[model samples]
Target: IIATVGNGMVIYIFTCTKNLRTPSNLLVVNLAFSDFCLMFFMCPPMVWNCLHETWMFGPFACELYAMIGSLFGVTSIWTMVFIALDRYNVIVKGLSAKPMTTKLALFQIFCIYLHGLFWTLAPMLGWSRYVPEANMTACGTDYFTQTWHSRTYIMVYAFFAYFVPLLVIFYAYYFIVKAVASHEKSMRDQAKKMNVSSLRSGDQNSTSAEFKLAKVALMTISLWFMAWTPYLVINFSGIFQLLTID
Candidate 1:
C-alpha cells in the first residue's frame, strides 16, 4: 500500500506539474511509474493469493504474474543505474557535462524497458521458466529445477540484474561523493581567503539538488536490495544444491 500510494503520488505530481517536468526529473518519473506498475498490478493479486493460501489464478496466470513482476523489477534496477550515472555526470563533470534533454531521457527509458522485456520474455522463450514459488502463494523464475538450462538462466540473470547494476551504481556514487567533497574543500578555501564564515548561494542550489536526488536514489536502491536480495540468495542456493528447492 505504501509503495502503491507513494509511487502513484510521485507519478501524479510529476505529470501534472510543468515545472517539475525537467529532463532529469523525467528519470525520476520513470522510476516511479515502474514501481507503480509493480505495486499496483503485482501486490493485490499476491495478497489475494496469500490470503487464499495458494495461487488460485492457475498456471497461465501464474506465469503472467511473474512476468509482470520481473519486467518492472528489471526496469527499476536499470532506472536506478541511469539515475546514478546521471548524478555522476552532473556532480563530477559539473558545467562540462552535457545537459540532459527530454529526447535523451525518453530514449534511455525506452531502452531500459526494452532490456527488461527481453530478460522477462527469455523464460517464455525456453531459456528458463516461471513456476509457483515454494510457498505456493507466489510465482517466480524456476529455481527448483536441477537442470543446467534453468540454473544457467538464474546465473546470467543475476549477473545482469544484480551485480552489474550494483557495480555501476557504486562507481557513479563513489565519484559523485568525491567530487562533492572536492568542491566543498575548494569553496571553504576560497571563503577562508576572503575571511567569510562560508560561501553561500550560487553553487549551493546545485549542490543541494544533487544531494537530494542522491539521497532519494540511495534510499530507494537500499530498500529495493534489502527486499530482493534474500530471494536472489534463495535462487542461488537452490541452483547450487545448498538448499532443497522443495
Candidate 2:
C-alpha cells in the first residue's frame, strides 16, 4: 500500500505540476509508473494466493499475473539504466552535453516497454513456457526445467534483462564519479594555490551538487545490485546444474 501510494503521489505531482515537468523527472515518472503497475496488478494477487495457500484465480489468471509482473520488473530495470545514462551525460559532459528533451524521453520510455513486452510474451509464443512455481501458488517462467529450450531462454533473458543493464549502470556511474572527483580536486588545487580561505561560492555550490548526485547514483546502483544479484545467481546455478531448483 505504501509503495502504491508513494509512487502514485510521485506520478501525480510530476504530471499535475507544470513546473515539475522536466526531462530527468520523466525518468522518475516512468519508474514510479512501473512500480505502481507492479504494486497494483502483481502484489495483491500474490498476497491473496499466499494467504489462501492456493492460486484461487485459475490458470489464465496465473499466466497473466506472471506476465504483468515480469513486464514491470524488466521495465523498472531498463528505466533505471536510462536514468543512469541521463545523469552520466549531464555530469560527465557538462556544457557540451545535449539536453534530454521530452520527446527523446518519451521515445526511450516506449522502447523500454517494447523490450519488456517482447520478453514477457516470448513464453506464450513458445520460446519457453510459464508454469506454476515450485510452491504451486504462483507462476513464472519455467526456470527449473533442464530442456535445451528452457536453458537457452533463461540464459538469453538473463543476459539482456539483468546482465546488460547492470553493466550499463556500472559503466555510467564509474565515469560520473571520475568526472566529479576530478572537478573537486581541481577546485581544491586552485583554492590552495591562491591561499583562499575557501572555494568561491559558486564552486562550493557546484561541488555540493556533484556530491549529492554522486551519492544518489551510488545508492541506486547498490540497491539494484543487492536486490537482483541473488536471483540472477540462483537462475544461473539452476541452469548450470550447480543448484537444484526443486
Candidate 3:
C-alpha cells in the first residue's frame, strides 16, 4: 500500500509534468523509485513465504527472487542512511552543500544499485560471498537466522546504520535545542528585570518549540530502541555463545 501510493505518486508527478522534475524532487523521485523496488521486491516474496512457508518456485526461483528482494531491502535500508546524511548535511551546512543536481542524483541512484549488487549478486556468484550449506540451499539472508555472520553483520549494521544516524540526529537537535534554551533563558532573565508584559508571547513560543524538539528526539530514540535493539541483543547473545564455544 505504501509503495503503491508513494511510487504511484512519483510516477504521476514525474510523467504528468516536466516542471516538477527539479533536481531535488528528481532525487526524491529516484528515492521513490528505489523504495518502490524495495517494497515490491521484498513484500510479495514475504507474503508468499508466509502463506506457503516454503519455496514452491524451486532453488533457482528462490535464489533469483531472494537475491532481488534482499538486494533491494539492503538498498532501501542504506539509501535511508544516505538520506539521513543528506538531511544532516543540509541542516548543518545549509545551501553550501546545496541541492543535488539531477545528474548527481542519478549517479547516486546508480551507486545504490551497485551497493545492492554487492550484497545480493556478489553472494550468489560467490565474490562477496554467502556459503550455502548442503541440502538446505538458501539465499544468504535473514541475518538473524545465520548465527555467525548474523552477529557480525548485525553489530556492524547497528553501529553504522543505527548508531551513527542517531548520533547525527542527536547532535543536530541538541544544538538547536540548546540555542533555543539559551535564548529563552536570556529572555526570562531580561523579563525578570523589566516589565513581564512583552515577554509572554514570542518568548513562550520559542521555548515551546525547543521543548518540542527535545520531546521529538526522545521519541525518536525510543522508536530506535524498539525497532532495532532486540535484533542487536540477539546478535550480542550469539557473540557471547561463540566466545564461550572458543
Candidate 4:
C-alpha cells in the first residue's frame, strides 16, 4: 500500500530533526506514521494468513488487528486530503502554513486521528459487531463483509473513510494546480512583455526558473493520485457490489 523509499527517508529526517520541520513536511511525517501504523497493525496477521490461512492469535487479537489497521488506513487518506487543503490555503489564500503557532497544525492532526478512532471503534460498542464469515477460500472476513447489518457499517465507513476525503483531495488539488498554472502563465506573459523592453539577462533567468518549479509541483500531484488510486479502486468495487444482483 505504500512506496517511495526516497521521499520516505526525507520525511523521516524532517520529523526527527527539529530544524527541518515545516507544516508541509510535518504533514508528510504524519502520513508516514499512518502508513507505519497500518503496517504494524496489519502486516503480521496478513503474513500469517498468507502462510497458514489461520489466526494464530485468538478472536480478540483478530478483532484488535482489524480495528487498528482500519483506523490508520482511513487516517492516511485524511492526512493527504488535509495536506491538500493546507497547500491550497498557503499558495492561493496566502495563509501562514507553518506548523508552530497559536493556531497550529497539531490540532488538525489530533482531529484526523480522533475521527479515525471514533469511527473504527464504534463497531465494537454495539453500533456494530464482528461476525464469523469466510472469504472465497475460507479466510475470515472483515466486519463489513460478515453479515446483513454490515451494510450500514460499510456505507458509513466508506463515506467518512474514503468518499469525503477523496472529494476534498480532488477539490483542493484542482484549485492548487489552477492557481499555480495561472501564476506561471502570468509570469510567461510578463516575461514576453519584458522581452521587447531590453531587460537584463538575470530577470529572464528568474522567470524561467519559476516556470520550471511550477512544472515540478504540477507533476508531483500525480504522486498523490498514485498513492490513493489503487485503494480507492478496490474500495469502490466493494461499494458497487451492493447494487449488483448475484
Candidate 5:
C-alpha cells in the first residue's frame, strides 16, 4: 500500500510538474510505474494467500499472478539498468551534451516493457510452464524441475531477464565511478595549478552530485543482487545437480 501510494504520487507529481519532466526522469517514472504495478497487482493476492495459508484464487489466478509478478520483476531490473545508463551518460558525457533525447527515452521505455512481456509470455506459449511453487500457494516458472524444457527455459530467461540487465547495470556504474574519479582528479589538478584552496563552488556541487549518484547506484544494485542472488543460485544449483546426476 505504501509503495503503491508513494510511486503513484511520484507519477502524479511528475505529470503535474512540467520542470520535472526530462529525458533522464522518464526512466525514473517508468521505474515508479513498474513498482506500482508490482505492489498493486501482485502483493495483495500474495498477502491474501499468505494469510489464508493456501492458494485461495485457484490455478488460473495463481498462474496469472506469477506472470504479472515476473513481468514487473523484469521490468524493475531493466528499468534500473536504464537508469544507470542514463546516469552514466549524464555524468560521463557531461549533461550539456544532451546524451539522451525525449524520443530516444520513450523508445527505450517501450523496449523495456516489450522485452519483459516477451519473456513473461514465453511460458504461457509453451516454452516451459508456470506452476505452483514449492510452497503451493503461489505460481512461477518451474524452477525446481530438472527436465530439459525447464532447464532450457530457466537458462534463457535468466540470461535475458536477469544476467544481461545485471551486467549492464554494473558496467554503467563502473564507468560512472571511473569518470567521476577522473573528473575529480582533474579538478584537483586545476585547483593546484591555480594555487587555490579548493575548486569553484559550481565544480564542487557537480562533484557532490556525481558522488551522491554513485552512492545511490551502488546501494540500489547491491540490494537488488542481495535479494535475487539466492533464488538465482538455487535454481542454477538445481539445474547443475540434475545434469550431474543424469
Candidate 6:
C-alpha cells in the first residue's frame, strides 16, 4: 500500500503539473511509473497468497507474477543508472551542459524498458526457469537448480543486472561529489579574494538546480541499495550452494 500510494502520487503530481514536466523530471516520473507498475501489478496477488499462507496461484500464475516483478524491477534499476548519469552530466557541466529534452528522455526510457524485457524474457526461453521460492509464497528465478545452465544464467544476469548498474551508479555519484566539492572550494577562494561574504552572485539558479538533482539522486541510490542488496545476497548465496533449499 505504501509503495502503491507513494509512487502513484509522484506520477500524479508530475503528470498534472505542466511546470513539473521537464525532461529531467520526466526521468523521475519514469522511475515512479516503474515502481508503480511493480507494486500495482504484483502486490495484490502476493498479498492474497500471504493471507492464505501459501501461493494459491498455479504454476502459470506464479511464472507470470515473477516475470512481471523481474521486468519492472530491472527497468527500475537501469532507470536509476540513467538518472545518475543525467545528474552527472547536468551538475558537472553546469551551464555548458546540453539541456535534457523530452524526446531524448523518452528515447532513453524506451531503451530502459527494452533492456528489462530482454532479461525477463530470457528465463521463459530456457535461460532459467521461474518457480516458487522455498517459502512457497513467492516466485522468482529458479535459484535452487544446481546445473551449469542454471548457475550460468544467474551469474550472467547478476553481472549485468546488479553489478554493472551498481558500478555505474557509484562512478557517477563519486564524480558528482568531487565536482560539487571542487566548485565549493573555488567559490570560497574567490570569496576570500574579493573580500566578500559569498561568491554566489548570479549563479544561484544553477547551483540550486545542481543541489536539488544531487539530493534526489542521493536518496534514490541509497534507497536502491538498501532494497536490493539483500536480494542480491540471497541470489548469490543460492547460486553458490550456501543455501540449502528443501
Q: Which numbered prediction scores highest in TM-score against the true structure?
A: 1
| Residue pairs of candidate 1 with colliding backbone atoms | none
Off by over 4 Å in 1: none
Q: Tens digits of per-residue lDDT for model 5 on 1-246?
A: 898999999999997899989787898888899989989997788788889877788878878988998899898898898888888777877756567889999999999999999988998898888887656567788876768888998899899878898888888888888987887798899999999977769646855876797778679778977888887876687667742322
Per-candidate RMSD, Å = 1.4, 2.1, 6.6, 4.9, 3.0, 1.6
| Model with the higher TM-score, candidate 2 or 4 | 2
Q: Which ten residues in a row have the lowest lDDT in candidate 1?
A: 206-215
- The total of clashing pairs for model 6 equals 0
Mind giving the per-residue lDDT tens digits that candidate 1 earns over 35-143? 9999999988888999999889999999999999999999999999999988888888989999999999999999999999999999999998999998889899998
What TM-score quantifies how close candidate 6 is to the native fold? 0.94
Number of clashes recorded per candidate? 0, 0, 0, 0, 0, 0
Candidate 2 lDDT, 1-246, residue by residue in tens: 999999999999999999879888898899999989988997788788889887888888888988998899999999999998998888898899999999999999999999999999999998878887767667788777789888999899999999899899889889998988897788889989999966759646765775687678679668867987887787677668887644
- Runs of candidate 2 exceeding 4 Å displacement: 200-207, 242-246
Predicted structure 3: lDDT: 0.57
lDDT per residue as tens, model 4, 90-137: 666654544344246677788888998887777787665543323321
TM-score per model over all chains: 0.95, 0.91, 0.59, 0.74, 0.88, 0.94
Instruction: TM-score winner between 2 and 3, please give it.
Output: 2
Give the per-residue lDDT of model 6 (tens digit) for 1-246. 999999999999999999998898888999999999999988898788889888898999999999999999999999999899889888887779788898999999999999999989998998989999878788999888898877898899889999999999999899898898888898899999999998676658767677777977788788888998898788879889999965
lDDT of 2 at 206: 60
What's the lDDT of the predicted structure labeled candidate 4? Answer: 0.63
Model 1 residue 211 lDDT score: 70
CA-lDDT, candidates in order: 0.90, 0.86, 0.57, 0.63, 0.83, 0.89
